[model samples]
Target: MTGFAQLLDQLPLRFLLASAGCLAAGLGVWGATALLRRLPGVALQRSTWLLGQATVLACFLVILLPHSERLRLVPPIDVADMAPSRAAAPQGPTARPAVGGAPAAAVPGADPASWLTLVAQAWLLAYLLGFGHAVLRLLLARRMLDSLAATGSRLPCPGQPARAPVVIEVDAPISPMLFGLLKPRLLLPQHLRGFDAAQQQLIVEHELMHWRRRDLQWLSVGIVLQTLLWFNPFMRMLRSSLSWAQELGCDRDVLRSRSPAQRKAYAAALVAQLRLQHATPKTALAFGGVCASTLAARIALIREPSPAHPRRARVVRILAIAALACVFAASLAFQPALARRSAPTATQAPFSCTVMVDAASGEQLAREGHCDERVTPASTFNIPVALMGFDSGILKDARAPVLPFKTGYPSYNASWRADTDPSSWLQNSVLWYAQQVTTGLGAARFHEYVQRFDYGNRDVGGDPGKDNGTTQSWVGSSLRISPLEQVSFLRKVANRDLPLSAHAYDMTTRIMPKRTLANGWEVVGKTGTAPGLGRDGNDDATRQYGWYVGWAKKGQRTVVFARLVLDAKQESAMGGARAREAMLRQLTARLDVL
Candidate 1:
């Protein structure tokens, strides 16, 4: 039971769901094509096939869009929440303590959950490696074609302009193929010179038809999609079907305005090229050399070609469009909604909130809990405080001088044992340091900046006469903000849109910690913790509230997020440390961190 649960937890349910959707789309496309084959003309078959492929691609895209609400369908499971048998849990160390203190608990043995996680990670790595290798192979094939084009001589045909695809006769054993995107060229095998002018024209016409239709560009798109979804066999099958459809479509176009004799000549040319044993580059579109089954289908379709009926073709077009619309709509509508969990138990902490937004577009990617619920900004207020301090010239620089630690202050954290600079103060969450900065800025100036930045509720003046009303209001007193607000503020800071001096903005960013993951992605942010309040408005010593606000950047993509974990029990809380851990776990699970 444990192993099975662990396996289920590690399963890539989302990707599996997408694969199933693609399979359904493929079946629909194949069914439409099967029906088209029974119709009178081959003209509608090409458009039908193209529309089916497009529909499948569109459906796959819809599946990839960010749907935070649907995330409930695969809510993450916290392994720590699971009850473990006493015997399976780690026991106290049997050996005597070393010089530091009592020996730590024995290291826990690997379990089913850990093994399952490792297996999942391995599979992901394999898929990435395969995708990279496939891309490299494509690049190599393009290089090979460039080399062939460079060495081969351009065969001049009368009436064909120089700008037109100059026919290049290469010393390769492969069949004639079309290569290049910007300056397309037709490359013919050396053996092709032995054929009569009529045979050569038939081969050239087919390759030229591919260029007119820009089949190379479409083929490139198909190749890229295949590489991305290499792990999905259905995607591979879809690529194959699309390619076959493309070849058939080109054949239909070539024979569209040709006589019966010309059609027979093109069919003979296709068979003659098939006898060659060489394989063409995957990146290029070849005239012949398709598989035996595809060759057979092409010949059969060519033998009895019928003229397209305008009215009947219009009807088929309408049906194809309708079918595509239905498939796309069903793909989105059928997405499984995430399962909502029941209320938390008494011992468990109340649900928290986390919202991740794209900094550039302000698009919400994923969210959990009630991100809009107002809560005290706690130490997170330090961000705006530092900004205001710099803008007002109250603080010159982040590293100018150090302030002596207030020895008389009562604090639970042991890290605040010595005087610290602005950076150190931010890192250690030294309340005294922030209080000093706020007091220096004073109430009027602070409130002005707060209102300007639209900080939280814009209520810097907390309940009067309270101990925390004046200077400490932004902490755990009265001033409040939500996860969504935090994200917005961070985005403004990142974009330098806030009303602050350039120096102040740079210093604020410099003081904040930036974490780099194994894959070279970076996360820059600050942490804040507030004291939880009881129903009577008194501080609740047993519970704490934590916040982690930051933006993660990889290449050109930047995601700003804010996480708030409330009502955490004392033993399980480390202020912002707890929030950071929770945020990182959720980010890893929801985002493609690897």
Candidate 2:
């Protein structure tokens, strides 16, 4: 859910970028149209159509493309994280701090992330509603056109029998208009039989030209794009302009070789048809995509067609194509905000890692976020300590050698105050018990075992000269492991590949916290959280890192996973528990059976 919320946060920015692209393309088309007014109408028409489609495509491209990571951070959002109670906001592995006093559980409207999420939801709902409404209009319009065509009588082609389209002479008081995309019907008037055969042929020829060029389909594309970018005013204007271009451009094609006398005759047909009204052409309708605004321009252009400037037209065409390429490239170039840190900052960016690997083959199955950046392993190291104890025979089994909590022992969690065996120790994350096991291993064997395990860096030397490697190396001192390394170690444990006694594998696996999924996959994992000096770690939080590592087994299949999250007290919550919940949610979403 949180991951989804982050994506939602980007919706507004995506729309803004797309809108800017539409504005650019619209301006370019306007300039191209003005320059080509003296040339063939087809040039302006085709350019408008092309640039409009490019704008539509840019809208989608912005959404599908990766966002700009170099965007500047929202400063005010990090201001509240300066409170001493929360330490400095997380810098290395940053997280959004639940609005200072707003509380993580019930984040208030004051928080930007919270409100941004709400805005995104509302925007999506509104967009879907608008799109659905547009679609319904198209469907109803198509139905009406079909009903009108049904009542009209079919007629054979006036002149070109072999190449003629299915002509329908409807009784409806409408002008001759081309209709339908897949099944284009050239609808003519029933009274056309009384007019001059040449006039009739001219009308049929005009609508036929639209059918041959598939202009209706292009108009439909424009309508859909207009719907998608309804919020962008420029898109609406571009669509209107493209509609004019479609009609005028078709005029240019139909009269391409006609002399002045023939062009005048065709212009007269358009002027006369302007008197009658037709059900505004909808989806699949041909020349009905034309408008009143273009009728006057069409007649004037047809009566005195421009002396074709082929050379000038070619130059404009090249420039228009170049502008289109620039628009699309600009859209793709913009990236989502959230850059990797290049230098120290007052706060950190959000950080998380979730990785899964095939236990047997050691092949990565799933990976997300930064998994290679190492951090403190914290209490997740308990799994290794448990194995070493069992292997050394110092720990016999899950229930043996029950040890009582000492008065001086660390017991931050109430559950750790009582006696703990291997099972309860893991269940409660009893830190003291792990220290006891390591202490019993006698420094030498402890280092030897960790080195044998090929664990992170294998430093285990504790902090500087503390001489406390066995007791606190994995605590917050020297032992650091990346999420990837954690997965590697876990794969061996799940596959029983480590050079440990049989009892070590069996006892450690038996004691770790286990959850059996519905598909009979037994998942066992451990959670860990650690605090450190905020200064040296380049993080603001004393409690900065969390880990959840484990493996899942079902019959012959086994998969190991490691998840890590970091925050500077983003909330009053245990990091390990948060990491566990998030990791499990991701696993549940991706895994079909296990």
Candidate 3:
């Protein structure tokens, strides 16, 4: 899927996580206010505003976090997790290489993760539609507000000085309101123009209090959050609460030091401004928004303002602060998804390395420990030897020019007792077949090929003039290659970037043993095993050295892989075969099975 689609698919998870944050912040602020019923209006107002801010902030946090591919809230499906479609296959290293069938199905919808797609794409599509509609509604409201603002005069109030905020005297029947963002404005209906200067002073002060507190900017934040989280009911609740708190706080601030007679005048002014609250944009922090019920509440509060409860207010403030901290923690903890990278492998082997890469881009697809360390290529070197044999016209086809096994040849594997061809030579790991091919190439030519290919140190001169370079250089001897180099070499071969002949490439690919996975992926590879294959520190024979190298493909895409494992002691299974089996299980879990 495209990056945009992936983001869309993740939206549901992000919204859910944000919702968790909103719930926590609401519980914190709302609960605190409930407990301290008589908390100061301004103090409670700030906390309520924070409650709204915290909800949106949590959503932003979730959106800003980096995407995780491997690890997600939903884990990718594994073959083992699938419902069996047929009889279970035998489990072991000895299983046939190319057995095929859809052994399993998607476990009747148990898994939610997509290998290269998202399960939540549908939810994202719906969310975008809702979000877009909300934004369009807001834009229309803004346009309406701008048009309404244009209908009023931009002159100062009759009695107010020339330097006061620009007063707009509108003939419309709206309440006195605070408007304008860049240049503050006090909006007054024409009916209020005849009020005494003292009453007008109280109205101006109330609107100015909103401007001084930067309430418009806070309102803008609420409008934006409403658009983004259009489906979140808590956001709607928070927005309403924020506006209510702002007005209450402004009223308290306006009448704080005024005499009882002045408070009575302010209450009377609020009653008069309740003419009509229509044509007001949701984005505006209008002082005239109070309905008859809200006006009654405002007048009640004005007649008998909340008494100072210093101790109770302090305790409420502390509780609000603690709630904020809890909200932040909950929001961060509820991130939509997390990366689940392949953990470091725990192995009985003292040393291990595994590396894989994308053939076309050369991007490192997967990795284990650092793959740069070099050691003997062991029997794994036969793959290169076979390629050289084919290129030099020393070897023919997959099943041609059968070469008999020598009496003294290493036949540790009983399967290597008979005459061998390219196919069986690799499958049975016949040492004689590999030596014959290498001996035919000779030392100088073999060394030249290794150097040209940049395979390891390319020092095929043997163990200090042992005159055995052709036979023993890669046999726990001089020649060495790292897992990184092995994967790089294979990637070049797959891309046909190597200097080998087409015939050679074709033959080598044909001869390599491959296993067919249930999902139609073909895993082709070679295994190498030897005793004391290390040159410097790891030369102990009891410590078996193993290597599994090759690639897997499903159509045009391929993944090249190389792995080396050094065990502390000899295992019942040949180290190379065991490594290949274990590696298959690991890759199968990823559904990449190389």
Residue 151 lDDT in model 2?
Answer: 93
Q: Write the per-residue lDDT of candidate 2 for residues 236-285, one digit (tens) a residue.
A: 67676676766666777788888887887777666666655464654544
Q: Which ranges of candidate 2 are over 4 A from the true structure?
A: 1-48, 67-104, 158-163, 191-194, 284-290, 309-311, 333-543, 546-594
The per-prediction tally of clashing pairs is: 3, 10, 1
Worst 10 residues of 3 by lDDT: 339-348
lDDT tens per residue, model 1, 1-594: 122332233244333445556667766666665565576653334455556666776665555443322212232232211222211221214333322221122235523244433544565567678889988988999999899888899887678656567789889778899888778888999988777787788788888878888787877777777777566565565566666767776778778877888788788878888887388887888988487777877898887765657787777778767766776676666644211111122112343667888888888887665454456788788788778777777667877558787767536577676777788878887777777777787767766787788766565545433434447777655477768788888888878788778988888878878887665568887888766655334566666778899888888888899998765466655667789988877766666632
> In terms of TM-score, which candidate is strongest?
2
The true-versus-predicted C-alpha distance at residue 92 of model 2, in Å, is 22
**lDDT score, residue 567, model 3?**
69
| Model 3 lDDT per residue over 127-175, tens place | 6899888888888876765676789877645765454567778787876
Which pairs clash in model 3?
71-340
Q: Which stretches of candidate 3 lie over 4 Å from their true place?
A: 1-29, 36-44, 59-119, 157-164, 194-196, 307-315, 330-594
TM-score of 1: 0.52
lDDT of 2: 0.67
Off by over 4 Å in 1: 1-65, 68-120, 336-594
